[model samples]
Target chain A: MPPESTSNSRQKTMVIVGILALIVIATAIALYAKNKDEVGTVTENPAQTSTTTESQASGSTVEYKDGTYSATGNYQTPGGTESITVKLTVANNVVTTSDVTTSQTSQEAAEYQAQFKANYSPFVVGKDINDITLSRISGSSLTPRGFNEAVDAIKSQAQA
Target chain B: MPSSPRLRLSQPFSLKFEAIGTSWTIEVYEAYDRLGDLQKSIQQRIAAFDHVYSRFRADSVVAQIAREAGNYRLPDDAAPMFNLYQQLYDLTDGAMTPLIGQALSDAGYDASYSLQPMPIRSVPAWQEVMTYDGATLTAKRPVLLDFGAAGKGYLIDLVAQIMVQADVRHYSIDAGGDIVTVGQTLNVGLEHPDNLNQVIGVAQITQGSICGSAGNRRRWATYHHVIDPHSLTSPKHIKALWVTAPTALVADGLATALYFAPADSLRRYFEFEYAIMHEDYSLVSSPGFPAQFFGADS
Candidate 1:
């Protein structure tokens, strides 16, 4: 009778150890899942904020009307303050011609203007005036410097 | 490792580097010095030169000349290129004409390389339409001059001169494939035409200019950018040519012209040491060329 009671006690002890191990495993898995959820949420939060910020920054789009729109901006060069005027001939939402009228630019800047006229203007002629990237010309450095400044001013005024 | 101590100077000095088109940067050891100001002044001077000589801009002197079919008067800044053009015209036996723009256009390079293929048409010979009289350039017919071959190299030479004028002793100007070096030695790796990843030869350029001409990167089919004036077609004989000279412009211009010239004639013209790669991957160099350029016996 004593032996049977000892054996039963040992079996009960083993079962309790098994239960404790299962509980520890479950707890570890739960903690790991919680940590993963926290990390995922934290990572997604910045992405969501950035998306909202981007939407806010670029939300406004400029509307173009049929007719000629012109704007001018002055830039400081090595020689003097040069004024660059951009005259855009917009018809049916497309820009026909983007002519730079003012001629206070340095000789280098003038060369920039001619290149802009020859290379860039042709590509933008049939494209939507508002949606076209005026900043793409920035790769040309000097030419883009004058043109982009003028275009940015026009873009802001048009948006307003 | 011990760090080197910074030396204190009694007077300030300015070093200026001019290369890669109109862009220039100045390094000054001291602030608010006359030398520093001079560096900026030198930069402006070079920038003005760049403006006048730039072929990318339609209002540039080169562009104006091109638009007017070499009829326009050469600007003071472009006098050097104009002179070099005349020299190259005579040197190539009229093989490398500045008026090869129509030929390049007809060979499917009418616009920028980034653009797609345009309609290819037969172009008339450049020598038949264009004429130059040392100072004045006149076009008898509608002719286009494309200085793509020698433009970058000439620009490099100009920048090297500017650096010398500015008293910058140690520097290098590398515009794409064209390179000019001064002061310190610069290691130049000659790219293999078949495999761009590998270097076929390496040369140490100390004070001279070196140019590599190959159709590996810029070409359509077997016909590459280097057009033979005699045949008006891409030559299949030579795959690559590398030349070094006192001036970058000459080296670059000769590299392109010789690639298109007949093998025998080219060998005769290139009396100097050079490395030539044949279409079948066989390589040959001038006997006078330094054997040290190649790691092993060629």
Candidate 2:
């Protein structure tokens, strides 16, 4: 994410210092892992799926091949089977961009999908929950002041 | 082999409470031991703010202003809140006004939560009804001033300030839907307005704030919370909008302002990233907005 537009030089300096500290901490962890014979852990995930002979010929484990990859995930929902298309661009072992598009077969699912597009917030998607945990949701809150009371009042009135 | 750049994770101490007619969730990193006292302090702070700001309460300063017009002394923090409102009011040509409180009440989003529409009343111009000089607010007539647009976000920032003063550097504060993150990055889901079970996308916020506003939540008799005093009707052009700014106040205020004016009109005055979902469900967003959509790729 880009820095806040209004961030001043002081904030920029702090960010730089923070980055340096993170790098130092990362180096220490890396050294510790190497000492424990765990140097291969970083490349394990990518190496499992990779079919590239270039990395094997070079005698080095490449964390990720810089390329665009796309996949379609099909899931069974109550309405029907739904498919989601996920596209990712990786650069230097880090994901540079990502996109997900949903395809629904049923009309009910289509309606819900239409509703989904009508609402928005800035949110990040990751393959794992551990990778990026959702802090909270930013959208039109479902809760309203005295909503339950109003509902109950209407129910009681109807019953009467 | 390359080491992953991800940081180690730990559980953050969480606090949940309801105030100002909304829910508040605060998560503090490495501050688990401090939360016991911090919770009380936060509650007290919100109570104090409600005493001054809440129009629902009969004893609130806002209620006093509604009852009669006079020179009222406001809390010191009112400067930023009022100043932002003044700026937005001018920028939108009175589309966004503190004076909308009366109109809102007329539409029955009043103190009682009546949700019943009454004859709509046009909001008076700021110059005719009230004037403020940061500290003292001079009201010429009984006018209801509602800070509903950004008060929650302002309160969240105030709570964040308290946490920072207590040496809690890493934290996230979420009130209703507005959120702020500091010293930690968080993935926040963008809830679908019609269906709470679904989300359109997720956004990554680090040391920044994000707020969203939509007319779907509080609708009654073809009206939602965001009522245009001029039209005496709720805006229908946009379905929902979200903004990410350096502070929650800006994000929250702009979320409401976007209902009145386009992002380009407000961009010159505030620095923020925005995504607006039109009534047609076509999404428009800033280039640098840190989010990934569920169905935007097509």
DockQ of each: 0.01, 0.15
Please give the lDDT score at residue B22 for candidate 1.
25
In order, candidate lDDTs are: 0.50, 0.71
- TM-scores of chain A across the candidates, in order, are 0.34, 0.33
**Per-residue C-alpha lDDT of model 1 across residues A26-118, encoded as one tens digit per residue:** 223333434453211011111122121111112233334555444444444445554444454544533455444446446755654454334
Error of 2 at B211 (Å): 0.3
What interface-residue Cα RMSD does candidate 2 give after superposition?
Answer: 14.6
Model 2, A1-160: lDDT tens digits are 3364453434333322322232223333344444554422121111122222110111122244555555443444455555544455544433446554557787755654444434321122212222334657778754555964764575577699
Return the DockQ of model 2: 0.15
Tens digits of per-residue lDDT, candidate 2, B6-120, equal: 3233556788878888788888766356677888888888999999999989999999999998999998999999999999999999989989999998988888887778998
Deviation in Å, model 2, residue B241 alpha carbon: 0.8
- Model 2, position B27, has a per-residue lDDT of 80
- Model 2 off-target regions past 4 Å? A1-133, A142-145, A155-160, B1-10, B296-298
Tell me, by DockQ, which candidate is best.
Answer: 2
